[model samples]
Target: MDGLQAYGAGKAGGAFDPVTFFQQPHAILRIINWLFSVVIFGCIANEGYINRPTEEQEYCIFNQNANACNYAVFMGCVCFLCCSGLLALDVRFPQISGVKDRKKAVLADLGVSAFWAFMWFVGFCFLANQWQASKPEDNPLKEGGDAARAAITFSFFSIFSWGAQSFLAFQRYKLGADTAIFGDYADPGQEADQGPYSAFPGETVESPPAGGVDGTAGSPVGYQRQEY
Candidate 1:
């Protein structure tokens, strides 16, 4: 509840503080994701290339085949950029602070999170499969083998990381929904702008008269007047 209140306050034009931002679990996870993606990108782009098969074996071969490595590098770059952008937005914009904005942000996060999870799963599988299929016969020695393996491993790890993010996003989305309809995280008396019975602004409510219906100053309780 405190978290939700803080989030609402932040959305309502509260000053954004870096210390508070980093305290959130989501921020930590995103930072880790971005750093891991950068590592994977470096490995695949720098050390995951191999010589391409040609009719004549040249002493110095300029051709290279990096099919699986290419895909991994692409995924890494995309994920890295996305995570960085999200981090910046969290600090500057933080649309998730408000209930309505939170719903939209959660939906966007769900789609992006699911997409990244699938991409990571596919990337690791393809890289591993290609690495296995390209095994050499006698005295097998592969170039960039360590980097390729590392990239594949990180890709696999990213699947669960992204899945966990999706789970958190889904929970936040539900919270947004509940807040919209039932004021779940709001204060006890005030309903945080939800529900039908809202206290409107500047609308005055009149109190009942001190005198009874018959204008008697000291009318007893439940007194009734008889008409002729």
Candidate 2:
């Protein structure tokens, strides 16, 4: 009756490790990266090209430019995107599942991967096409700086995005035919035997440490009211 067993993502699932198979962290990381892209990228785009030296000022993403416009809007969009992805992955919107939606998600994942790939491609061309400096006018793009930044961003997204998708695809191939796909699976040694956040009723459980054994304990972050 366990899900992901054959059809779901349990024992019947394809792999024992969902993190490697599904790349849960990488997927979550995508959301975080996009967050920076939105807040940082969009803000710079809005400021347009300032003169050159002061242009670095335009590159600034926070403060003075933290208004609800430009970068703020882009960051909001990225936030919505990541949140939506989490909801889907968590099945929080099971009531809204459909083939079209699933396929769309797949395509979006692929598209992002391809975009990152293209960015790297362009960056390579930048280095490849560097002009010889006989006269000082060599290498027109002055893009040396921009090229480096683009390369760094492109590398980060390319590796993470494509790597994650590659994992999903490989898992499907490995366990797709008569195999199981598990978004999540538990290991008795790793998971709590009680259950989901399982705490036995009428039993007081000892708290875990911030970075101690299994790291499962600790109160919720933020201010805690003390008892009188």
In terms of lDDT, the best-performing candidate is: 1
Cα-lDDT of candidate 2: 0.40
lDDT of 2 by residue, 79-146 (tens): 44654564355332122234234334444544554554454344334322331211232222342334
Model 2 off-target regions past 4 Å?
A: 1-3, 6-23, 39-43, 46-48, 52-120, 123-160, 178-228
lDDT against the true structure, per candidate, is 0.68, 0.40
- lDDT of predicted model 1: 0.68
Model 1, 1-228: lDDT tens digits are: 223542223444567788988988778879888988998999877866544354333211111344666677788999999998777766654534455555566677778988999989998778777766664531134556677678878889899988887787777677666656555544655443344444565443333357866678766445786799
Ten-residue stretch with the least lDDT total in model 2: 59-68
Clash statistics: count for each candidate: 0, 6
TM-score of 1: 0.70
| TM-score of each model, in listed order | 0.70, 0.35
Best by TM-score: 1
